[model samples]
Target: MSTRLDDAYQWANSADGPVLVAVEERQDHELAAGSHRHARGQLFGSMRGLLSVGVEEGVWLVPSSHAVWLPPHEAHAGRSHGPFHGWSVYVAEPACADLPRRPCTIRASGLLREAVLRACNWPIDASTAPLAPLAASRGHLAEVVLDEIRTSPPEPLGLPLPSDPRLQRIAKALIDDPADERDLEQWAHWGAVSARTLSRRFVSETGFNFSAWRQRARMMRSLEMLAAGAAVSAVALDLGYSTASAFIQVFRRTFGQTPAAYRVRL
Candidate 1:
């Protein structure tokens, strides 16, 4: 973990409550909090950046339009891909019964976002009652927030990272520069493994061959770049796609929206 994120993690350290909220307004904020567990489940909402959240299953790329729900005691770590502005809502056991049991990213609906943002300002200590009018209302917005999470749509935008050291290094290199068009044989040479060995390892570790993994990496990166306001053609070339049209085809297929459409929605 980077020293900067280590510092950012400080904001996340709080007393677990039936509902606890922490807001981070800095665009460059990030945290790796490490492969640690929290007694309460958490909802991570990113307002303006891409977040790379890692758990036991894999790493998920969360764009600005999304949020991730992590069940209780599930070891996880997170880092920002760019400028990120977000907050977290931690809910203790029974209160989190309605949320997803496994790690998954959900679309942050406007209502859910408002509920979370509102909760951030009020005291979330369930032991004590809130005094604010908005918070003191009879509707009990906290439950509303969790209900919104339960119904929100899930997005299939995560690119799983290989756990094995050799494959992990290769995955990182490719993610760092998706434009690199190195073949499996060339990457095998860099890893000091036979091409056959590397190919076998790639499938076993991530369930995706080299080419497929690279494609997924490129597609995920394109979402981040697009969220940052990059032009279609520029993002395409940056991610090693030959042309804007080709990139558009893949992007449309992967995300079900054109780059322009996606940005407009964001």
Candidate 2:
């Protein structure tokens, strides 16, 4: 783990602090953190590059403009698509009562970003009386940060996973190769389940039907590829889109911007 991540874990495990912020800048190599859980909820975001966070439920792609929220004690892991610059805010379990209860991708508003950057300068320890006023100010700032997080709208950056072993096998396969180009009947046969059952279960377990879920998988993968400097046309073809136009349309609908524009921002 990087120093910032280690500090985040320490702050998260400490009951003495209600909230703490950790900032990191890494340009040498991509980041890959192993699965772990802490006693505190985390709001993690990047100002540059893309990050993917995974939990038992699914994976969420965190673009530079968005953040992922992990409720307290949620087992999760994270990997950056490329060089990353980000911040993490750890909120004590007791202080997370009003936060979102599930893992999700949220808009990282300007106000929230500024508040976190400011809070980074506050003292990490809460026990010192001489810094009591600073600590109080930090507490109020934390409240603003939390409120911004609570009010920010969620982004459709997550690909939810199914619980059934059979469905899970299929989900993994699709994530491994989003360009598989298999129909429902084909996938159902591979999973050894009837097409009707596969279709129904996908909706019941993932809230998305087979086709929709596959498209979402492709979209998420495209985000990572694009962030890594893949050409827009190449990404479209790699993800099984018949034409660049089709991919561009989907990308625009999902993110309100074309892949090329997103890459420029990165």
State which candidate has the highest TM-score: 1
Q: Estimate each model's TM-score.
A: 0.77, 0.64
Off by over 4 Å in 2: 1-7, 23-38, 45-66, 71-88, 92-103, 107-151, 255-257, 260-266
**lDDT tens digits by residue: candidate 2, 1-266:** 55555555677766554455545445567778889987778888877656767787665555566788888889999877666677888877766887788888876766888898887655454343321233577778888988977887766656667778898789878877889998999999999989999999999988899998898878877876775678999999999999999999999997789888877765
lDDT of candidate model 2 versus the reference: 0.76
Candidate 1 local lDDT, 111-164, one digit each (tens): 788888776665333333332223345237877777877787766647777777
Q: CA shift at 215, candidate 2, in angstroms?
A: 0.9
Per-prediction tally of clashes: 0, 0
Q: Which candidate number would show the highest lDDT if scored against the true structure?
A: 2
Worst 10 residues of 1 by lDDT: 124-133
TM-score of 2: 0.64
